[model samples]
Structure formats: structure tokens, C-alpha cells
Target: MKVGLIGFGKAGKAVANVILQSNEYSLEWVLRQSTILEHRHVPEFLGIDSKEPGLIFSTSSIEIEELLSKHPVDIIIDFSSSNGIYSYGKAAASRKIIIISAISHYDEDEKQFLSELSSKTIVFWSPNISLGVNYLMFAAKLLKKIAPWVDIEIIEEHFKGKPGVSGTAIKLAKELDLEETEISSIRAGGIVSKHEIIFGFPYQTVRLIHEAISREAFGNGVLFVADNLADKKEGFYTFEDLLSPYFTN
Candidate 1:
């Protein structure tokens, strides 16, 4: 499978490294919003050994359709901002390319746009794509179902300077019947990722925790989504939708 990446930030670089190391996927091109590091080969820049072109470019360097036409890819893994999809989504869907977005958050309009695109091609979006985090969410939901009266709260910790509350925590809050205000967030140091769901019972408490020690966790998630959705039919799929089948009891 040929792949195109849509962001070049720290996390994006880590994801690119994962693709370079994967024998099943070829990194074809990367598009970033900034002009820095424009026109660099992804493998040479990351010091990986692959013959794939994997070139990098600024979004402004070329039109979105032209870029897709010149370097076609089977999938476009997006670690870019929410609006980044606005640039290439329709164009890629028109070409029947699958999209997996790990963008942290998207408003209602963006959700609608993605839903519409799914009619043409597979569209997979996850607020938090770390497989472990998604697993944590599923486990928490199960515990809640088993004991609906138990009180649940979510806690998330990330590196400092995060601009908003953790979207995963917010989703957890919704699942466990808590408000966004009830989800706690700690932004300090260089914490890769941490989420804990505390279920308080009358006699005791159960704590379910997932901590990501590296950004490569998300890269593995990219691979998981790729493997599962490779031959899936055109539709809008959530991380939970794809991950749920593997959670068979």
C-alpha cells in the first residue's frame, strides 16, 4: 500500500518513521502546512533505509489534486490539524483513496463533511488513535455496563501547553454520564500520554489506566487501522467501530 502523510510535527515525524519501517506500506509523500523542510526525502530526513520516494512538501507548493494525481496513494494518514482535511479530503475521496484521521477534535460541521465523504470512500477518524487508549475506553464502558450505579471519572495527563481539554476524556465523560467539567487534565513535563478511569463502588474502587511511553503508540495505531480497514467497504467508521470487533468475549 502507498501512503501519504499530512503533518510533519513531532508526532507526525514519529508516524512517518513507523511507515518507513513497515514492509507492507510505502511512504509516498508528506504534506505539511509550513514551508520548512520542504522538498526533503522522508527516508533520508528520518535516516530510514527505503527506496520509496517519500518526499515532503509544503501545502502551498502544489495544488492538492495535482499532488494526489502525481503521487497516488492507497491511504492518506493524517496527523494534521482538523482543518487540514478541508484541503485534500474531497479531492482524495474523488480518487477513492481511504482516509484515517487522528486529529484530536472536530466540530459538528467537520463531522458532517466527513460523513458525506464516506459515501465515496472509507473515512476513519479517531480523536485518540492510540490503541491502548481506545482499549481503555472500551474497558471502562464494559465496567460501567456491569455496574451502572458505580460512579466514574476520567483523568488525562499530557505534555504542557496543550490548548484544550483532552478530547478522549470528554468522550469518556459522555460515556460514563459525567460532564466535560468533571474530566480532570494535567498538562506538565513531557508526558507522552496518560488516561485513567476510576470507578467508585460502595465497597471499593477500580482504576483502569493506560499510559503511552512514546509517540510510536500512535504509529502502531495507524498500522492497526490500516490492517483492519484495508478491504473495508466505503463508509464512515470510528475508531471504536473498527476496534470493537477485536474485543470479542
Candidate 2:
């Protein structure tokens, strides 16, 4: 499969490296707002020019569409911000290309846009793409199923530069009837990702924790999603869906 990456940030770069190492896919094009020459190492790190990389730098939607037409991408993995989600999703949907975004929440406008493409295209969405977190979500469901009496609380912490609460934590809290549970966040040095789900009773406490020693952990999940989703058609899918193959119990 040929892939088109829509963002060049940390997560994007990490996913790109994964694609390069894997044998199943190739990097077709990387879309950005600046020329390749402007950033000295962007080309080297992205394997640009090594195998004749197709780097696209454009601010116009028409230009992006034209580039996609020329290259003919199978999937567009987007880690772009919230503002770019609607426009990029629309553009990719208009072309019937598959899209997977790091941003998860969809307002009414995005919902309508997705509804328009019901069977023709698919846009996989996830707030957090770490496979470990997906496994944690699965565990949460199992705990709820086997011991629904257990009370659950989720806590997540990230580096100081990171912003916002863990959408996954909130989702888990809401799922386990603990949305009102105390959520503690920490912003400190050298931390990538940390999450702990605690279930307690009078005598014992059960804890499930997933720690990310590096950003590559989350990026690996994104690459896994991109690689596995080439043949799937229109609908909303998540990292949890990707882990379903191993979730048989």
C-alpha cells in the first residue's frame, strides 16, 4: 500500500519511520506547508530523494487535491490539528480516499460529512492510538463484565509540554460509572505517557497500568492502524477494533 502522511510532527515522523522499516507499505507523499529545501533534515529523516520521495508543500485545497490525483493515495494518515480535520477529512472523502486521524471528537458538522460518505469511504478516528491503551480499554470491559461491582478510577499524566486531559481516561471513567472520580494530572520532565486504572475494595486494590517510555509507542499504534485498515470500507473504527483480533477470550 502507498501512504500519504498529512502532518510532519513528532507522531507523524515516528509513524513514517515504522512504515519505512516495514515491508508491507511505502511512503508515497508527505504533505506540508513548506518546501523540502527549507528544512534541511526533513528530507533525510523522511527518506525523501532516497527513493524519489514525493514531498508536497501547499496551502491550497485545490493544490492538495491535484497532488492526490496525480499520486493516487490509498490512505491518508492525518495527525493534523482540530482545525485541519474537517477540511482534510472533506478533501479526502471527496476523493474517496481513506482517512485516519489522531483527533477523535466529531462535532455535528463532521458527523454530517461522514454520513454523506456512508458506504463509499471510511475515516478511522482515535484520540489515543497506543495499542497498550487499547488493551487497557479491553481489560476495563473485562473487569466490568466479570466483576461489575468493582469501582474504577483512571488517572493519566504527561510531560509538561503536553496539553489537555486524557480523552481515553475520561472515556474509561464514563464507561465504568466513575466520571466523577478524581482524575489527577502531572506535568513534569521526561515523561512521555502514563495511565493507571485503579479498582479498589475494603481489603485489596487491583491496578492496571500502561506506561510509555517514548513517543514511539503511540506512533507504532498509528502505523499498525494504517497498515491494517487498507481494505476496510466506510465507517468509524478505533484502536480497540484493531486489537479485537487478539481480544478473543
Candidate 3:
């Protein structure tokens, strides 16, 4: 698959590295906010060995239509800001391009826009796109369904400087029908990301945890989504939709 990426921030760069190393993807280009690294190749920028074009372009330098025309890709994976979708989503939909977004948070209106956009082209969005985290949520939800009375508390930990509660933790709480107050967060050190769910029983406590050792987990999740969405029709999809089949009663 030929993949185009948006945003060259920390997460985007990590995802690009994974794409460059994967046998399943050919990174065609990257678009970001600045011109500092304009036209630089991903491999050269990251000091990795790969043969993909991996060209960098500034949004200010070219329009989305021109980029799509110049670099036709099989899919576009976005690890950019929550508002990044606004820029390229409609244009990509016009061309029936597939978009996989790993944006962490979106308001109701932004979400509705994506849901509507899916009518034109396939749109996959996941705040916590890690396979492990989604699986943890899936399993946690099942456990709650089978044992609804089990007391549940979610704990999320991140590195210093992360504002607000963890989005994944909030999603998990919502999935389990727990209040936002049921979530706890801790920020310290250089922790990449960590989420733990503790199910309390009268005599025992079962803990399910998913920790991202590195941002590459998101990259792997994208790879997984790309492989699965390859044969699906146009629609709005989530990580859970892609992962539910793997969990059976």
C-alpha cells in the first residue's frame, strides 16, 4: 500500500518510521505546518534506510488537491492535530481516499463531520489506536458485561506535561458505563503512556493493563487497521469495529 502521512510531530515521525520499515506500506509523502524541512526525505530525516519517496511538503506550499494529484496513495494515515482532518478530509473523500486518523480527541461536531464524511469515503478514527489498548478495552468491557457488578476503576499514567485526564481512560470508562470521576491519572517521569483497569471483587482484584512502551505502538495499530480496512467498503469505522471479531464468547 502507498501511504501518505500528515503531521511530522513526535507521533507522526514515529509512525513514519514504522511505515518505512513495514513490508506492507510505501510512504509517498508527508505534509506538515512548516517549511523548515520542506522536500526532505523521511529516511534521510530520520537516519533510517528505506527507498520510499517520503517527500515532505508544507501545507502552505501546496493545496490538498495538488498534493493528491501529484502523489496518488492507497491510504492516508493522519497522526496530526485534532483539527487536521478539516483540511484534507473532504478533498480526500472526493477522490475516495481512505483515511485512518489517530487523533486523541474531538468534539461532538468534529466527530459528526467524520461520520458524515464516511458516506463518501472510508474513514477510520480512534483516539487510542493501539492494538493492545483497544484489546484491553474490549476485554474489560466483556468482563464488565459478564460481571456487571464488578467494581471498576481506571488509572492512566503519562509523562509530565500531559494536560487533563487520559482520553483512552475516559473512553474506557464510557465503554464500561463508569462516571468520569471513576478515572484517575498520574503524570511523572518520561512515561510514554499507561492505562490500567482494576476490577474489584469481594475477595480478589483483577487488573488489566496496557502500556505503550513507545509511540511505535500507534504505528503498528495503523498497520493493523490498513491491512483490515483494505477490503472493506466506504464507512466510518473504529478500532473496536476492526478488533471485535477477534474476541468471541
Candidate 4:
């Protein structure tokens, strides 16, 4: 499979490295606005030889369309902000290319735009793509069934530079049919990522936590979703879908 990457941020770079190390997928193109003035040397930043074949680098949608026309990819992995979703989503949908997006904090307009785009092509969207985080969502469902009377709350902490509440916490709350206000967001230190689900009962308390020690955890989950969704039909999917097998077992 051939793959295109959008955004060269921390998560994008980590996902690209994982793709580069795999023989199953070819890293074809990378789209980013930050490299428009970098003399077309995007591969250099990715530690790849500049002369590598089938690797097109561009900073705009026009260039991306031209490159896709000449060298089409099977999928495009997006780690960009919500603002770029409509443009990138429409571009990929027009080409019938699958999109795996890990972007978070989308406004209502952006969310609706993406939902419409999914009608044209497969869109696998997940804010928190870590398997453990998705598994936490699965666990939340079970808890809701087994302990319906318990009060639940989510606490998420991330690096100081991170913005908005943790998507994982929001997802967990949504899955459990709880209010978003039940989540607490913390930003401090250099914490990679940590989420705790507290279940309080009249007599005892239970807690479930998942801590991301490194970016590789997220990268692995992205690759896993990409590989699983590569052959899937055109539709919308999520990381929780990837955890179905575990729950059935």
C-alpha cells in the first residue's frame, strides 16, 4: 500500500517513521504548509534521502492534487488540525483515497463537513488512537452495565503545551453516556499523557488508568488502524471498532 502523510508534527513524524520501517506500506507524499519555503526538501526533515523515488512533497492543495494525479496513494494519514479537515478530506474523497485522521477538537462545522466527506470515501477518525485508550472506552461500557449506580469521572493530564481537554476523556464520557463536564483536564509538566477513570460507590472506589509513556504507543495504533482499514469499504470507522475482537473474546 502507498501512503501519504499530512502534517509533520510529532504524531505525524512518529507515524511516518513507523510506515518507513514497514515493508507493507510505501511513504509516498507528505503535505505540510510549514515546508513551503524549505526548497522542496521535505524528506530531509524525515531523515530520508532527498532523491528517493515516489516521495512527493508539497505545501498546498494544488500541488497535492497534481502529485496524486501523477502518483496515487492508497491512503492518506492526517495528523493536522481540525481547520484543515475539510480541504484535506475533500481532496482525499475526490480521489477515492482512504483517510485515517487523528485530529482532535473539531468544531460543529468541521465535524459536519467531515461527516459529509465520509459519504464519498472511507474516513477512519479517532482523536486518541492509542489501543489502550480505546480499550478504556470498551471498559467504560462494561462498567456502565455492571455498575450502573456508580458515579464516574475522568481525569486527564497532558503536557503543558497541549491544548483543549483530552480527546480520550471526552470519548470515554460520550461512550458511557456521561456529561462532558464529568471530565477534568490538567496541563502541567512534561507529562506524555495520562487518563484516569474513577468509579465511586457508596462503600468503595475503583480506578482505571492508561498512561502513554512514549509517542510510539500512538504511532503503533495509527499503523494498526491504517492496516485494518486499508481493505475496508467506504464508510466511517473509529478506534473502538478495532477493539471489537478483544471484547468478543
Instruction: Find the candidate with the highest lDDT and give its number.
Output: 3
Q: Which candidate model has the greater TM-score, 1 or 4?
A: 1
**C-alpha local distance difference test of each model:** 0.90, 0.70, 0.92, 0.78
Off by over 4 Å in 4: 36-56, 60-62
Candidate 2: clashing pairs of residues: 121-234
Give candidate 3's whole-model lDDT. 0.92
Across 1-249, the per-residue lDDT of candidate 2 in tens digits comes to 777877777777776666656566677767766454332343476664445354545444336767777777877877666656655666687777887777645566765665665456777777777778778888887887788887667788887877767766776776677754467777788687788988886689989998978767766787778777877767777776677877675
Pitting candidate 3 against candidate 4, the one with the higher TM-score is 3
Give per-residue CA lDDT, model 3, range 125-208, as digits (tens).
998888999999888988998899999999999999988888888899899999999899999998989999999999999999
Question: Candidate 4 lDDT, tens digit per residue, 1-249?
Answer: 888878777777777676777767777767777745233433555676534343435564456667678768888888878887765677789888988888867778977887888888988888888778778777878987998988988999999989878877887888878898888999999898899999998888889899988866877887789778866777888876667866688
TM value for model 1: 0.97
RMSD of 3: 1.1
Clashes of each: 0, 1, 0, 0
Name the weakest run of 10 consecutive residues (lDDT summed) in model 4: 49-58
Query: Between the candidate structures 3 and 4, which one is better when assessed by lDDT?
Result: 3
Off by over 4 Å in 3: none
Off by over 4 Å in 2: 34-43, 46-56, 60-62, 104-108
